[model samples]
Every structure is written in structure tokens, then in C-alpha cells.
Target chain A: MPGWYYDKKELRHSPSAQDGIDYKTEMRYRKEGARLIINTGSKMDLGYNTMATGVVYYHRFYMFHSFKQFPRYVTACCCLFLAGKVEETPKKCKDIIKTAKSLLTDQKFTTFGEDPKEEVMTLERILLQTIKFDLQVEHPYQYLLKYAKCLKGDKQKLQKMVQMAWTFVNDSLCTTLALQWEPEIIAVALMYLAGKLSKFEVVDWMGRNTKHCRWWDMFVEDVTMDLLEDICHQVLDLYSQSDAPIHPDSPPLHSNAKQQMPSLRPSNGQEKTLSPDRPPSVNAKGPPLSDVPQFPYQTFTGAPPPAAAYASVFPSSMAGPPGGPPPHLSGPPPHIAAPPPAVFSYVNHPPPFSTVVPPGAPPYFPANAPPPGQPPQHRPYYPPQ
Target chain B: MSFEKSHTYEALNRIGRGAYGTVYKAKDKKTGNDVALKRVCVPLSEDGIPMNTLREISLLRQLNTHDHPNIVRLLDVCHGQQMERELIMYLVFEHVEQDLSTYIERHSKGFSGVQIRSLSREILNGVDFLHSNRIVHRDLKPQNLLVTHDGHIKLADFGLAKTYDFEMKLTSVVVTLWYRAPEVLLGLTYATPVDIWSIGCIIVELYSLKPLFCGESDGDQLSKIFRVLGKPPESEWPEENISIKWNSFNVNSQISIDRICPNICETAYDLIMSMLTFNPKRRITALEALNHRFFLEEPINT
Candidate 1:
């Protein structure tokens, strides 16, 4: 089984070509799919955590699969179905499918077959493989109350800040912030964003001294104001894209962040309508077969079918790497593409301790330096500047 | 695409049915080590994969990170094509010879107090690990407790374990009725202490060589419990605390531990009593039970 914890280094990823979908395309489908979850999940009476978890699964699923091959709405339904189970509030598959089909008013949402259940199950197995059975997803909501209690601000202001931050955390799920940042970082970012909205001096609320550190410092040791601000901007970007209020300095949010996102904003009180502009072009040619056809089913068996048949079921571009799916799809797979260009020191993969060791340092001097076999040492200690 | 080549486990024989799938005793062809392969049959439906499967996987991953001997290790997870359409998910775990129930049935003559103490200590250790990590092993019964050939015990079957949340209104009816606590029977909000109650029941059952409360139904199960512990007082469990309407019942007296299992020592009786207390708050915690005089009375080495 693949390990769950990744520390900026050794986070696995396969190139977008391997999955036959570009990163942006996959992200768009994931966003739309997550929106479908919110639309359908509201009817099923799922909690916010379940919605957040379902969205995380959607984002994580695309890290391995291509949206072009696996129909976005079906995959979204599968994610919610799985999320419902993971969050311990299970719903029947038929009910989820019915609700999803009803919400996906657009004809483009391909019906894999007369009954979408089988296709959803097929996708469910792939979903499990993509996640490597590492099903536990830590959400920022779990930390919101704790952070709120620690803020040394006015009672009423703290309450309002918590509410704002809570909404920000939900909206952040709409963006790729959950995938890009740690849950604690998102929580801290939302808190800061909430404070800014309320005009509360949150930066030094926990006291400036290191001994009496900010609540974020207690949870995330290496977190800085810049990273928190960046996360806040990512969340704010989601709000701007939707009809919701955006922070003053942030650019206008993308159009995709429309009102349909129930988890992101307060209900707009408008009748729910699926946009007709999005056409069902992806599967317009294929017959709607509820059960996988015999040849495709055989391809799913252990025997490797010819590339052509396998490609039909799983497009060549979407084919998994020659080996089993890599452990964590946090960065590009080592073989195919270069790791995503490093952003922050902690963003993609941390540089090895040896690489961080300054020009004239002794070969084996750094106490915490890797003993050579470790190529990607995540805990790179920058010696006192 | 194929997980088969990487995960090859040859089936030895079928075990019993698991919570949501078929279990088999298999040999890991790679390491030639015997292991239990639970073929979790995730039905082909819109519901996606079963949440129980996910919870078991997630909780086992967290619990077995450091490899505690008392908790079953999730050795591997692999997918197999079952039938033509259905997908079979195999959760590979360390194979144990028998469960606690089977072990007790085989050794019906009796287990020494020392053996019983060791078993209780091991179960408590597993429970403590789970509770400390804020997980509640909602189902803790003899059937879910696996025992190795060398008498080592481990808690298995985490289909119902979950990260504990206080305000979250989880379903009341979770654990098997026989091991269910009074508060659970009354449909009250529960926590880790509910597990301790089940442990108390198991301790009594282990000592007696039979189930402590073997009721055919939920109502009967509660009656059996009240028969043994006496009808619980209404004051401790207020009307507002539980959802169930209070049923007026009468019992002459609470059955003494001596009458139930006279062979067990006084310390063991006291520990069981502390655990079986009606008030969940008053119930002995897993850690406290570990320190009880019953464990100290007989050194595990003996």
C-alpha cells in the first residue's frame, strides 16, 4: 500500500500525457465535477466535510486519470459516493446516480450506459487505485474551531471571524488550494483572510514573540506570512470568480466560479439551471452501454489486451505508467516529465539536504544531512542565516 | 493497470465472512508467509466504494503505522477482477489461527487467570491505542478479536471504527448487541467508553466460557443486561439523555460477579465492575484498566 504522508519531496505524479489530459483541462473538469457533487450532495443531505472530502477525491483522482476518458459528471458522482462512505454518512448508489443525473441537466454529461451505476463502480475501482487506499483527507474545517478559540480578539468579532473563515475554507475547496497547500496552512490563511475582512488586527493577535507564537506557528512550524497570504489569495480568487464578494486587491475571479457552487457561497435564491452551452461532445459517438462490452471487460482482466482495445477503454494518453500508479501524484512522475518547477521551498519537492549544504561545508558535516542513499531529503535544515 | 503481478497471494482456504466481504487464509507467494486476504466485494453501483472499506483502510493505516503487536496489521491492499463485472478488493492482513470466540470454544475446559489477564491486557492495549488516536472501535466483540497460534491476540475487523467526534450524532446502534453498552442500548450519545463496556462484557464472557449476554434481539439483549446488572436507575440516565422511552422493569438484585464467575479473583471482579458501570463517565478507561489491580496481581511473565 502506498504511504499517505508526503513532505514536499517524494510526492508522486505521472505526466498529463500519461493520463491523456492536460493539467488545466483536468483541473477544469475537477472543478465542474466538484460543483456537480455540491449540486447533488445538497439533495442527499451530506455535511460540508463530505462535500470537501468529495472535492478532494475529485482533485486527487485527476492527478492520475484524464477527464476526457472518464466522464467528469460520472466520476464526480463516484467521488461523492465514495466520500459519503468515507465520511460515514453513506447513501445508496441508485439515489446518488438519480440525483446526479437530475442535476446534470446538460446533455453533455455522458450516461455511460442505460444505468450509470456500473460505470460509476468501474470508475470507483480506478478512483481507489489513484488514491492508493490512502483515503484519509484532513480538511481545514476540522481545525477552524480550535483556531477560532485561540484568537485573542473581541468575542463578537471572533465569532464573526470564525464564520467568515469557515465560509472561506469551504470556498477554498472550490479552488486547487486544498491540493496545493496543507490543511493547516489553508486554515491559517482563512483566519487571516477573515480578520482582514473584519478589520481585526490578526497578524499579531496571538502576540509577536516567538515563545507566545501565533496559532498558525503552533500548528505549521515553517509557515510564513507570504505563504498564508498566497493561500488567502487563492481562496479569495474563488470568491471573486463566483458572485460572492472579493478582497479589494485580488483580480476578478474566473467565470467558472459561478453561482452553481453551493459549497462556495450563500444560496443565490435562483432556480437551479444547468448551463446548455456545455455540449455532450465527448461521448456523442459511442453507444450508451450500461455494462462494459465483452471485449472491454476482457481488457480489464489481468491479461494485457492489445494496445488498441485497451486504448478504447482507457485512451493511450490516459494509460497509467508502465509500472503501477506511483505512490503520491503530488508532483510529476520522475520518468516522464521534469518535476513541476519548484515554487516555494516547500511547494513541490524540497531540495536534498546535500544540495542545500553551502559551498564550503564539510562533505559529512551537517548533522541532519542525508547519508547519500536519500536523493530527496524533505527535511532540509537551512543553517542559521 | 494490473495490480495482480505486484500482489500475488495464493488462497489456502476460505475463512469466515467479513463485515462486507469474503475472507480467505492465503499465502503471500512473494514472501511465502501466510496472510488473511479479505476479498471486499465492492458492489457495482452508484454509491461508489463502501465507506466501511475506506474507514477500515484509513484507520488501519494510521493505527499500524508503528506496528503495534496488539492491533492487526494491514499488510497489503490489492484489486482483482471478480466475476465479469464486479470488482474484488483484497485487504491483506496478517493471518491469525483463530478468533477469541473460537479460542475460548476450543479451550472450553478453562484458561488460567494469568492467561485471561494477558488477553485482557492485550485487548486493552489495542483499545488504548485506538482511543488515544481519537478512534472508536465501535464493534469490539469476540468475533472481531483475532488470536494467533502462540496465544498472541490482536484486534481486527475495523469496518466500524471511526475518528471520534463529540457533537456529531452518529448512529446509536453500532456494536453487536451482545457487547453493546447500557448507554448505547438506551440510544444515548456514545464515545470511547462504549468500547470499554464491550471489553467488560468480553472479560466476563471469557471467564465464564460463554457469552455474558446472549440475547436474540435488541430488547432481549437489554433485558438480559438489566437482569445481570439490575434495572439501571433513572436518575443517572435522565429522560432527556436518551431517545428510548424508559421501560418500567424490575429486578430483585444485581447478580454478583461471584455468582456469575466464582473462579475469577476479587481484583478481576472489581475491574470488570468498574468497566461495566452504567455511567459512561464512571466506566474505567482502557488506560486505567491496564493499571488495575487485576493486571498487577498476576505479573504477565507468569
Candidate 2:
């Protein structure tokens, strides 16, 4: 059961190192993340394990090799690509390079000096090799397994906990927490939090249709702040830091910037569109299960995202030091701006109040999600600034 | 950019084209291991290799963890160079012969009882291992089953297999139209029993040189099944919500198995009949079928 996600180098490195958990290192991750966001000129949901993959890659890369050996820019790209692959939110190399070129437009592209594109591309390849081509990023599955095993005595409660935890892990991409903690810890924290709010705090509200009332009570006992604290402080945001450019020389493109990727570049309707129901290719069908081995997606929540722009969340946190500012720390946006960009705000371990699913009963979900009779938790949707 | 690691291999002829990549039979220069190198040599565009790469990745991950002389093992995954985004997944196995389909096509004229039994047991062994782990090989056609030089049968290509979590079950059209099961044909929520239908097809194919349930459409396909095995009682079919009418199969009037194979032992006929049952709840599970009299008296390798 020991997976490739378990990295020894990461365990020994500072910051990302097991004991390297602290305030300063966490803040740097956030700052660098903002640089990536500012570079992209758009905001990713930073949800699920997208940001987590970025941050975790940073934490892992810094373990064995230093900035001396691997430049931060290349390392940054590695983190992003690796994390993107893990979270199943794969981004193209062109976008990655564009981000790098723009973000470090001023830095004398130390690796490829003249052509920033080649440098970023080359760095991306190196990162792919470093990770041994294993893309089964960890997610809430691992954490839920542990939680499920702990609640094995109570199958009914465990089932509910697993589903809620799954929802948290599934949508963690919406928050910056995925950038910080491992999926296991995040899973534990999410189950703990959900158990507290809907399952426990409002037991009177949760109509116990079956004889599983006592099991619900014990769920509350299982939650611990010690665990919650790790999720809160360790899971970080990259944009909250100073690297995020709040003013956006030209305000960040509104949601309608039509930032269609090159591969997805819209057609001028000159050619007939292929049927959306076109069959999966024969030889190139679906997930190959034949000769070469692949990692199960169940363990996809491990690695963190590369650099991001959530640093604006900690506009002040990303500054060189406390009061003395270099002027870029204004803010990422308003609501999602709480956590910085570089910081690994993991999805498994979401922040306290950012409801991935609003605080009401959704028709699709049947958890402590109010009654079919009750109204669903309706919340306003805001595009990421 | 350093191509410092000059790894060489004596590339031989291409074995076959998978959904996403071209598989080559090759020899490693240093180790001399007969490696099945799958090369995803294509652009990253829509026309590129299909789910072949991912299918290989997903299937091999689990099969590699398993140790069965009959199961294909995935050794190493190599992503090399700029010519094309090629992924060379190295496997330590030899290309014995053409796949089962080729073998059946050329030699099914009159497969000796022993030969048929041996093929069945080997196929069953590999299938049983997969089922025990709750993995269903959605595609179990002769094309995906490989025969080793020593006459051992190895199951490969799990691209269409369904691994259900505690939440949902994927019951899509995973098998080739010929080998696809009946429920999947009816668009019902199937579990592992679909594999049983596939096994039945393989069983008939062993005797008949043709695909047993081969049909042009879903309706025709089910008609072929009803022709061989009478329709399931309405009470047995919980598919009242389904719209693919049973009459569409045009077999409310019963038909006979003699029309399909005409040549097979009574026991083998009975087994196939049970396997091709429309009700998945009634299909023979892998282990239960293994204990049948066919394997008990027929020639079977350990």
C-alpha cells in the first residue's frame, strides 16, 4: 500500500520536509504561486488538488535539489505541470511556457536566455522525467480509506462520511487548500468538519431515519483541532501573497476574455464539426489497461500544484518582510483573495467557511443535505478576479 | 538537451495497432529481454492514438500487481524524445503467436477437445483472478487474449474493464459488437456477469469459426441471442424502464442453438446456454463455472 506519492526526499527537505511545516516557508509558496497566476492572466478554480499538486511539487523539488541546481522558474513549471497532470486538469505546455515567459519576462531566462519558450519547454520535460512519469496524484481516497476503516464498526455512518469526504475531495479544486496538505490529512479534516457541521452540530436537523443515531454522536468525538489546525494552517493559498498583481495593468480579463486554449481554439464554422458522440478511438481508446502500468486515480490527491496566483490572498503575506512593501501586494480579488497563490491551499483540507457546495440541501446530493422538502443551500456565484 | 542515455533496441515487426498506439515486438540490446514496447508515436491531436495509452496504463497497473503466468505483466514505462510524444511501456514477455482471434480463424476448423479445454481453462484462470479483485474485463474477445509459445493463455487489453467504486457502476458498450454481452446490448446496468457473456462467445468461437452473436445493431444482436437461448421471462427482466423492446430482437418466437454452432458437446452446449443467459443475476460466475464438469474431465493445465 506504500505508494509512489510517499517521497523520502520531500520528507527530508526544509519547508516541504515533514517537520518543515511553519509560517515563513508557507508564505513563500504563496508568493511564488501568485507569480504563476499573474503569469497565466487567468484564475484556475485552484480547486480540488490542482493547487495542491503545484505546492506539493514545489515542496518536493526543493527537497533534494536547491534553487542553485534547479532554477525556481523551471521548478515552478514542473510543479504546475505535475500537479495539473495529477488533478486531471492537464494544461498544455504552450500555456505553461507562456506563463513562465510572461512571469519571468524580465529575468534573463538563465536556462534558454534568448527564447523564453524553449527554456520553459525544456524545463517542463526535465520535470516530467524527475517524477518517473507516475501521475496518480493523491486525493481524498486515501484519507477516506483511513476514515472508513476507523468507522468500520459503524458502516452506515462510514458510508455517509465517505460520500461527503468524496464530495470535498472531488471539488477541492475550487479552493486553494489542495496546494498545502496531503490528501489523507485533508480527507480526515473534511470528514471531521462535515461531521461537525451537518452531521453533529445540527443532529436535531438531520432526521435520523434509521437507528444510526449513536454512530453520529461518536463522529463528533473523532474530530480534533490538532488535525483541523494542520488542514487550516498547512493548506495554503498562493494569490493571498504579494506576488499577485492586483491592478492588472489592464484589469484582469473579465470571465468573457474567451481564453480558449490553442488546442481548443474555436472554429470559424468553416468546417463541419465532428459529432460530439464520436466513438473513443479503437487503438487509442480509453484508459489503457494492457501492458504498461498506471497509477490508480484513487491516490491522486498527493502532490500539490505548481506556482499559482492565489498569492493575492495574502497580498501582505507575500511581501519580503512585515511592513516594508515593494508595492505588488495589493490583493488577488476580493472573496477568493484570502489565501495567496503560491501557498498550497489543499482541497482535501478546505478552509472553514468556503463552502465548496453552498450551505443548503442540493437535490443531487443526499447527505445531511437538508430534506427533499427543505430548500437547497443557494449561494451567489462570482467569477474569479 | 542531452540524449546522453543511448538506450538501443533491435526493433522488429509491428504486432498490432491498439486503440491509441502501435505495439512492436522488440529485443533490448543490453538485457535481451523480449519486450513488448507500445509506442504512442503520434501527435497530441484528436486524430492521435485513442485511449490506448491510458488503457494500457490503467490495466497494467493492476495486472502487474498480480502474479499469474497467464496474466500479462507491465515492466517499465519509457517516454522518449521530440519526434512524437511516444510512450514505450516495456513488458518482459515474448510474442508467442497471433492473438486468439487469429488462432481461432486459422485453426478452428476442428479444434481437438483437449485443445479447446486447455484454451478455456487458461482464459478462465486469467478471468477469475480479475473478477476476484472486483475488476471486470469488459472486453474479453479473442483479440485481447494472447497465446504464449508454451500454449498458455494470457489476458491482455483491459481498456474497457469497469472498476466500480462504492458509488457507481459503469455499464457502457465496452466490448466489440460481436463479443459484447446481452445486457450491455440492452443498455442495462451490468456488473461482472457481462464477462460471462464474453466467455460464452469465446466458448462458441472455439468451435464455430465465426463470431457467435455477431449482429449489425443492438436489436439484431439480441435477436441472435434469443435465437440461441429463448427469451428471459418478463418477471426475470427488471428492465421495465428500458425502451429497447425485446420484440425488437424479433425472438418472442423461440429459436434453436443448432442454428448457431451445430457442433459442440452437450455439456459445452449447456455451459454456453447458461453463460449467455439474459438475466445477469442468472449468469454463471467465474468460479462456479470453473468447477463445472468440462474442466474436471477435460485436459487442463494446472
Candidate 3:
């Protein structure tokens, strides 16, 4: 089986770096992308495991392909969509897109293009191929819970420490720690950090002995202090910085777009200046927005142009009616125009939306027919992306 | 990490058809090795890949890390040409010549005592490895057991296997009815004990050359089991199985195993009885079955 881990040198020379994205700029894009996946998954009522898996998928996908090749937001949505099914919490593509639209500001939502569903569905195939269909991802949360059970300490303090460690693991998803280390090592290191921060020492664990001076020794052999602190510092770095600025030199969006692109990196010292105490943009919350220009409907055919060259690929007709039906719903793309294969036709037979039908209404409503008193309109048809 | 593309393997012949897709005997052009290419057609619906297929591939990949001898090897997974709306995925596996069912069918004469002992021991070893790894092969009929040219057994077709920790409320309808355990037939929750029940039925089939308790339906399967093993006392019947009443089974006396399969020795009979116990709690585990007296005793000539 192919492994997911990469060494420090391999990660430093990642595909994105090879595509002309500086390491710091690529890291900024990763943090924002991970945050998007976690936020989207939480809003959809998915568990932490599903969200972490999605983030891991995002990180791994960028390793094989450059961030310049694919838009971070679109890839984030596709990752979460695939993770939901892999984790056994299935959600419709339209529902996920709907939640994303509600969460994102109108400016950022433009990246989803005219048909958000088609964009995400199309990217799903590339995500699966890039990951090589190795769907199992072991996260640190399970190990943190398992190790906490073995420690003998004050119940409340232990619970608090474990909770802090769990949050650290969640934040660690933004970094490349997942690509660099196994879940066991990461779990042990985070638990040590939590214990130090909470002032709770594991003096009496289940298998405490003279040889096992440190609690982690009982779980994993030969864990050096240097390794644990290095892991802890990576997670701590997330809190030390307020936010990173988006690249200003990139092409500007439409004038009416609501999103406010922040000034370029402080080193550049060109373009509009950012206020020292400027209030954070609510449309794009969380980590500072990265410099990469968002490519809404850019196709991944051949060697994609670098991030600086993305202006040429931007669709000219992006300013469409906000919440109206898609312009091309009447004539879908030729590939999905045909009826779905009969193998899984039963799944499509039921009415698509669960919220539309009133209680005690007929269960066998024709998919094409609207409910009583409802106007006849095109219910958004989702063809295979 | 580049994967071997689908074009590298030349199709030789069609071997089998499954609910997922067809399996073909293919040859690697570069290495000159025979491989089994299982074609899985994934419908590109709103939901990208099927959940069951994802789980199956995930579980198999994890298990493949150990490289157990009795488990079939998943050599590679590569994408083929994408059809109009369906994606073709080929799971390349090490090919085996025959399955256990065909192997049993080819031997018109009864198997030697030594042959039966070796084959049964190999089967139990495979089951024990899976159980130790916290995986349950939900479907374990003869067709799923591949037989190599040298008569080695390699467990294959893990489409229904799952990695379980505690008592999971798994799908109620699993396993072929002929090899299904009573707990599954009665709709009661089950775990690894279900596999042991199937092994017990298989051990008897090794001697009788046919299924022990063959039935047409779930209820009929339980009836057939009761007729042979005799109905258990009301207290032993699981309280959770409300659909199956103790009185529904009219078996008044238990049939002797020797009458059903007289060719087996005394120790073999004892081992089979322990494996076919009515209660899953009392059913012989794979490890325990491996250490039974039948395996320890001298082989009796047929």
C-alpha cells in the first residue's frame, strides 16, 4: 500500500513550491483552506473526524498538484463532500453548496461560478484519483481519547487537559504536521503540550514504572523531548500570528464584488496600505486570506499557468443574477444529459428534497411535479459532475 | 507515487461476475505475472463514490499492510477509461486458479484424511488472523475462498467485511443463508461469532460434500438448524429476537451428527459439535477451534 507521509525535505519542495508559489504563501493558502473545510463540515452537522479527514485530503491533494492549478475554496468543498460519504454521513451535493453559499460572502461565493454543484462534482473525481483511493485516514482525536483513559489524575483536570489537546489536534490540521508525522506520534506530543499548559502532570498512569519516567514512554518508545516541543510549536504558531495578508498584486475582482482584497505582503510596501487596527473582514473570517487569486471555473486540462497568470482565465460573465435558477438548467452538459443509469435509479426515484413535502402528503410525488399550490419550476437537477 | 496504469495489463479471460462488476484474468506485460482485475463501476451520481465501496477499499488497504499469507494481496488500484457517467476502477489482485467450491467438486472421490485436516487448518488460520485484527469477514461461503494450484487457501472478496470494535448494529441480512449463524437468521445482533458458525457449517461440508442446513428462506433456515441441533430451551433463546418464538420450531429430538456425516472420526465429530453450538457465546472461536483435540490427535486413515 502507498503511504501518505512525506519527510521534511519533500514537503519543503512541494508541488505548489515548484509551481512558483513561495513556501509562506502556500502555507497561508493551506491554513485558509483547512479552516473553510472545518467550518463547512461543522455547519453541516458532521463530526470532527469527518472534518479532519477533509482537511487532510485538501493538504494531500495540493502535494500532488499545485495550489495555482486549482482554486483552494473549490477544492475545500470537494474534499468535504467526499469525506462526508467516506465517513458514512452522506449529504447531497446541492445541500453542501447551499450551506457554503450561505456561509460565504457574495464576493468569495463568486468563485463557485454559475453552477456550484457542477464545479464541486467535477473536482471530486480528481480528488479521488490524487489520493489513490486510499480512503482510511487515522486522526489524532481517537488516540488522544484512548491515551487520556489510561492516565490516573483528577477527573476534571484530566478532562480539561484532554479537551485542550483535542483542540490542538484540530488546529494542527492547518499545518503540514499531518503530512510529516503519524497520528500516534502527533497524539503523544499534543497530550504532553496539553499537560504542560493545564498544569496537570501524569504522576500515576496505568503502567507507571522506573523505566518509564515520562508518561508517553509507556505508549510509544524513544519519544525525545525535542520532537514533542517541535510539534507543539507548530500548533502554537497558529495563535501567535493575527492574520496573513492576501496578495495585492493579483488581479482585482469586479468593482461591485463585496469582498475587500487586503493589501499585499508587508515586504512589498506597494498598493493601498492596510490600517494598523483595521477590523477583520467578516466575509472572509479565520486565518488571513492567502495571496492566490481564486479561479472559479478554471479547467484543469494541461499545465496550468502560474498564480500570476490567473487573470487571463477569469470568466468575463461572472456577474449573474444572484439567487435565480442556473442559466443552462434547460440544457445540461451533454455528458449528464442522458438519464442516470438503471443500476442506482432507485436512489433518484424518491423526491429530491426532504423539506419540501408537508407531513401526511403523498410519498410518491412525481419528481418533475411540484407540490399542491406550489408553482411549477425547475427543481435544480444535479447531474454527475 | 505513480500507480500502474490499466493499459499495462492485457485481458486474458473473464473469470466471474459480481454485484460490483466483472473480474478478469489479466497478464502484466512488464512482469509476465497473472493478475485478477476486478472492475468496479462507480456511478457518478450526486454522491461521488458509493459508501460501501469506499469502506471496502479502505479496510482492504489497511489489512494489506500486514501481508498475511492466507489473505489475497491487492497489488494495485488504477483508474480505467471513464465512461459516459460511470468511472471504471480496476482493483488488481494476485490471481488464484480455482475456488474452494470448484476444488471440492473436482475431487469426485472423497478427500484423504490428511487433505481434509490440512485444508481445515488453513481455513481456521485465516479466520484467526482476521479476528485478531478486529475484522469480521461477514460473507465466508466456499465461493469466497480461493484455492491455489498447490492447495493453499487465500481468503478473497472482502466486499462485506468490516472492522468492528464493539457490538455493532450491522446490516441484519448478511452471509449466504446456508452458512449464516442462528443469531443473524433470528435478527439478533452479532459479532465475530457469526464467522465461526459459518466455519462450523464448512467443516461439516468438508466431510459430507454438501451443505449441512440448507434452507430456502430466513425462517426456513432457522427451522432446518433447529431440526438438526434440536430446539434450545426458552431461556437460551435471545430475548431481543421477538419475531422468532421458541414454539415456532417443532423439533422434539436432536439428530446425531454421525448419522449426517458418518465418515468423520470420533474426535472430528466432537469438534464439529462444539463449533455448531446453539448459543454464539458458547460457539468455538477460531483460536480455540485450532487447538481442539481433533487437530491434536493422530490422523485417522479414510
Every prediction's TM-score for the first chain?
A: 0.58, 0.41, 0.63
In terms of lDDT, model 3 sits at 0.68
Name the weakest run of 10 consecutive residues (lDDT summed) in model 1 chain A: A345-354
lDDT against the true structure, per candidate, is 0.62, 0.50, 0.68
DockQ-wise, the better of 1 and 2 is 1
lDDT of 2 by residue, A1-385 (tens): 2234333334334444344445444445434543453234234333434554565555444543444455566666656655565555666655665556654545434654576455555554455444444444556645554444444323333333344444444334333344455565676676654443223222232233464443333333443444463343223221122222433332122121111110111123222221112311122222222321111111111111211222232122221112221112222222432222222212222111222232453321122223333422321222123
From the highest DockQ down, the ranking of the candidates is: 3, 1, 2
Model 3 lDDT per residue over B120-187, tens place: 88888988988997777877888889999999999987644332211123234333589999898888
DockQ-based class of model 2: incorrect
Compute the lDDT for candidate 1. Answer: 0.62
Query: In model 3, which runs have C-alpha deviations exceeding 4 angstroms?
Result: A149-161, A197-204, A240-385, B1-10, B18-20, B27-33, B66-69, B105-110, B128-139, B148-150, B161-201, B208-262, B273-292, B296-302
Residue lDDT tens for model 1, B35-127:
998765544433545455577677777677778888898888777764453456677899888999999999988888888998999999999
- Please, what are the lDDT tens digits per residue for candidate 3 over residues A313-341? 11111111111112132233334322221
The Cα error of candidate 1 at residue A332, in Å, is 50
Better of 1 and 3 by lDDT: 3
Point out the higher-scoring one by lDDT: 2 or 3.
Answer: 3
Residue pairs with colliding backbones in model 1 are A12-A328, A12-A329, A13-A333, A19-A318, A20-A317, A93-B47, A108-A280, A113-A290, A241-A253
Q: Cα deviation of B25 in candidate 2 (Å)? A: 1.3
